[model samples]
Target: MFLTQTVPRQREIIEVLFRNGWGYMRKLLTGGKPEDPQLPTPAVLKKIFIDLGPVYIKLGQLLSTRPDILSSAYIEELSTLQDEVPPVDWSEVEVLIRKQLKRPLEETCKYLNPVPVA
Candidate 1:
């Protein structure tokens, strides 16, 4: 049943893994073009956990402290994870801001960056 439902997303998942320079995993997933200078694996892992949602976020939080299981650099990166809502595109954020404030994003703040700071 799980396989039936998620078969559609399998391609997406594999592409994500491969693009993250996890291409060794391609045998288990669809092909993807690797990004040059490849994204930091820790950041990629963080994004995956965030995409997987809250329960996984909680798991990430716990795993962040397990130095024996992950490398120091990975632990440092994982430690930055927070159990907050995942990030969305700035356009969606602008829409939400306007809906809640009942005003355009330009009117509410002195400055708004088109892209969020990571």
Candidate 2:
């Protein structure tokens, strides 16, 4: 019932939940039962957040700050959640840099590395 046209990402979210073995969330999403809520293991939860992308990573980071809600183990694990973005191609980044500078990339910096450090 909840998996309607309006919520297009519902299916994807459910799939991720299922893949991560988050039984409680899967049940909640698919409207299986109204049982007590339960969370997966801390590491599993972190993996789920990672699979869900930036928004959920941010949510996990925020959740990590809440010592009252999560146990130390969960907080510790979630605290390490970093946004794992794929590296952008140097060509794309060079173009953006050129646009921002309103000039050639060479004119701005003498020795800019193509590879990202961070």
Candidate 3:
């Protein structure tokens, strides 16, 4: 993850891990009752994935396919993983495309939609 992510995103991931640890600690300290309602089991996993972002969602998908490695219940929950990304503004996509291709998007494609393919 550190290899693939920019510095700020790596920091964000570590912060999420700390948040999860604190969540568990709060549960333990209060004997399972908390100010906020406790998350359901699947909700906790989903929260973790949503915080971590797309790469982790892809990792969860890969893990979900390994029935021998995970119990049926866990596999079932993980199979629900989605990237949960909002659509990027086309301007950002154009920037990314230009950076990768080292040319303007118009130069590379005869036709390009401002909206992403989804």
* Tens digits of lDDT, candidate 1, 91-118: 8778878899998767779988777564
What's the lDDT for all of these models? 0.70, 0.82, 0.68
Number of backbone clashes in candidate 3: 0
- 2 or 3: which has the higher TM-score? 2
Q: lDDT ranking from best to worst?
A: 2, 1, 3
Q: Please rank every candidate by TM-score, starting with the best.
A: 2, 3, 1
Listing every candidate in turn, what is its Cα RMSD in Å to the true structure after a full C-alpha superposition? Answer: 8.7, 6.2, 6.7
Residue range 26-51, candidate 2, lDDT tens digits: 67767798588888999999988888
Clashing residue pairs in candidate 3 (N, C-alpha, C atoms within 3 angstroms): none
Provide the lDDT at 84 for model 3.
Answer: 42
The parts of candidate 2 lying over 4 Å away from their true place are 1-6, 29-31, 82-117
lDDT per residue for candidate 3 within 1-118, as digits (tens), equals 6577688876686677567665754565557766655443554565577668667777777877889986777678878774444555678777878899997767789988786565
What TM-score against the true fold does each predicted structure earn? 0.50, 0.62, 0.55
The better-scoring model by lDDT among 2 and 3 is 2
